[model samples]
Target: MTETALSFELPANLAVEKFIAKLSKKTVIELALQQYSLKTFYDSFDWRLYNANLICEFNQSKNGSSLSLISSLNGKVITSTELDDVPAFASEFKDNVMANKLAMLLEVRALLPLTTVDLQIYKINILNREQKTVARLMIEQYDQLKTRLSIQAIKGYDKAYIRLSALLQDEFSLKTAEKGLLIRALKRQGRKPNDYSSKLNLKLTPEMTAAEAVRVIYKTLLKTIKLNEQGTIEDIDSEFLHDFRVAVRKTRSALSQIKAIFPDEHNAYYKEYFAWLGTITGLTRDMDVYLLSFDDYKASLPESMREDLNPLHEFLLFKQAHAQKELANHLKSKKYLTTLHDWELYLKRFIEKEDLQKNTHISIKELADSRIWKVYQQVLNDGAAINEDSPAELLHDLRKTCKKLRYLMEFFQSLYPPEKIKTLIKALKGFQEVLGNFQDYEVQEISLKQFSEEMMQQGTPSNTFLAMGVLVQGLEERRGKARHDFTGRFNDFKVPLNQKVFKFLFAHKSKGE
Candidate 1:
């Protein structure tokens, strides 16, 4: 049988030299010590690596630096690469197994430095009868505050490992450690792996009032916006702005959909401000999308003509930077700051019973069912009315309706049967994708035409305009395809099983109405 590695915690007052002397007396041991200038753990802001059952650590020494990807479950190194310095993105790593693995897991997200610690290592060799090393031990002290001992078994030397483990346990009365030094260090700083994510996962109960549940949802969304604000202003990556806007949209959708859950005055103030927030942030986000998809944009054209789009790329970067600066200024403005602060205070403050709205006092389940069912019926009605020649406005309106329904389902996901609600959501998502793509393509095509006129006014080369025209034509084709696919996608969503699940889960209660 293969022996898995083991780690043990030493008592706070135990002296390392004294422990080594005691161990040497029991068994012949060879020791080597080394110190690292620094050891840091890194992951995406969303904790992508940690969620994938992996952790990345970088170690700096006098000679150079090294990065290793380790399995969090067993504390085994999967791959290691030597680097001159730390990289901000996975694509910067040298071509190797680690680079390939990281690229797959961390698409566009930048690696963020999470925790750093001063590390010292004491390596010990367990010898067999002939004085040949059979097993290895690593004693690590982190930040001079805690120490850990790890036992790694050598293949064909399980007996030695078992004997050593038994001796440590029986003679020293050492207890096994539940986690590694890196994890413990993170805990010391009050941070946990997998603590931050962009997705919404709320825990709500049916017994709560509609007003209470909405408050909880808004609070979470507000936290998300605050968390991503700095990154967005710094333009770290497109996702920060993307996540921030999503939270804002969700807040707006809640205010609009869950009508009468808040007083009219409160709802009107927030809805107007959030709409303003969305408008100011839209241009930068649009440029981000275009730039992120530029590679694919190039691929869609002929090889010889692709270079013609280079000017467009440069133009986009300039525009994006200008828009980003404007957005940063807006975010720092007194109006923006005060609005968010007021919204936060409103969500957090106490409310008198007499001031609550009609829906506020009803159970959350009733509100969820009523809102979701009403939207679901509207979706079916609107989708069934579209045909080969329906105006684009109909699909656009349906898209917004579908989004509102999606938000409601997600907000109230916890109050229903997990698998059943998930099934309905899955169906809705497929339908939404067709509508979303259809709308995005149409919007992009229109924007490109306007951009070409602007470029012409600025004396951009005529060939760039030709290239853009080709891009616009391509977008129109894709948009047409999506519109064509809508019928089948909508039909799939309207299938008997999906209809059954939606009705079974949401349509049963109409008490809020």
Candidate 2:
């Protein structure tokens, strides 16, 4: 059924019963109350649904459970499906319109429970002189104190809706509700949507000491680590572990690249710890990447050969689960806990010290300019050195250099002209994309071969082995293309416009500056 509804927030002090009693004086009012428990809001880790102005909720009562996908923009139920049970993953949804839509929106990501809320729904019918329903009102009281009022006009009753809206506004002081009840409740609990992201948002100043700047960066990374810890342990999604690994890598990069910012011994010690962290997570993340690409891998083969690939998929799944368990155990270990605690304490202690090391006293702008310029030139030289005849390892090494340069650019982006830095970063990213794909394809080829051996040992069928060979060939073709594209990508990055911007930002700085 198609209907238009307007949502508003009722003042906290207003009671639904009292409001209905007051409305009874103007017209006949009918009320129905619904108590919903185990009401959950679902979204991707990134809040894709909320960002798209969509609300997806699962409600369970004594009778059964229902899933509702509503469009917040129009307050309409886009689709509703009654399920025997709520599936943990979107792919597990039965064949239905709602499930299809959700699968498209959340392809590989699990639908994480953002928040749970208990709703007290009061459905009201406003009638006219003939006792015919003219309009409908839904007042949803969340737990207590918070209420959302929705007024929907019955078809052919626009005048009634206008009259009722005016009466509610004039008498009760209704205001347009900009946020959903789930969001409001989350706010009341001091949490908000999109509260975490993998990107760096730390604010660094030119006058801040190197120790303080390093502290700020590490603090942000530490928080990211902590934020993803629960999700990683629960195996909610691969991204949690992926993001955790990235944070650790960034922390390591900061320590090694931004030399002398912290004490030598501390930097060395934490670098080792972070290296351990990265190693422990490596197998799991690698398996996650392979498994996540399973669909594409299957499609790479002919239809006749696709069914044979199921065994490979099972093998990958088995390996992923095993690796994930190990990673979780490592995360929960005493050694891991002690490392994080010591690192945090180190940051706090060093940042508060009034005395500055020699390098820490320098202005961040000068330091950034010097280091970025050095890395930028290094990338150019390295990229220029590579040719069609160059070994694949050369390209791999150059990719690593590009990563360091990219991280430097991101860390000190605020110190330069905004547009200039943005343009340079964009160009660098395009170059890195080619290098990254090239490396990934290479890694995938090696991994598939390794898995084939393991599968054989485990008595995998010969058909599965043949399917894996086809997959390996497919990866090689992609890798070759990426290798071929490197020249064009490098040239694009080294174009005069980007070169000028990079030079203007980082080239003029000196050691003594």
| Best candidate according to lDDT | 1
Q: For model 1, how does the per-residue alpha-carbon lDDT over 115-175 read when each residue is reduced to its tens digit?
A: 8888777889888789888888888776555678889898988788999999889998888
**Model 2 lDDT, full chain set:** 0.85
Residue ranges of candidate 1 with Cα displaced over 4 Å: 1-4, 350-354, 457-463, 511-513
Tens-digit lDDT track of model 2 for 193-248: 87876678878988886667767888999999998998998899888898899899
Predictions in order: lDDT: 0.87, 0.85
The predictions' CA RMSDs to the true structure, in order, are: 2.1, 2.3
Q: What is the lDDT of candidate 1?
A: 0.87
TM-score of each: 0.95, 0.93
Off by over 4 Å in 2: 1-5, 9-14, 32-38, 62-64, 129-131, 173-179, 510-513
Candidate 1 local Cα displacement, residue 29, angstroms: 2.1
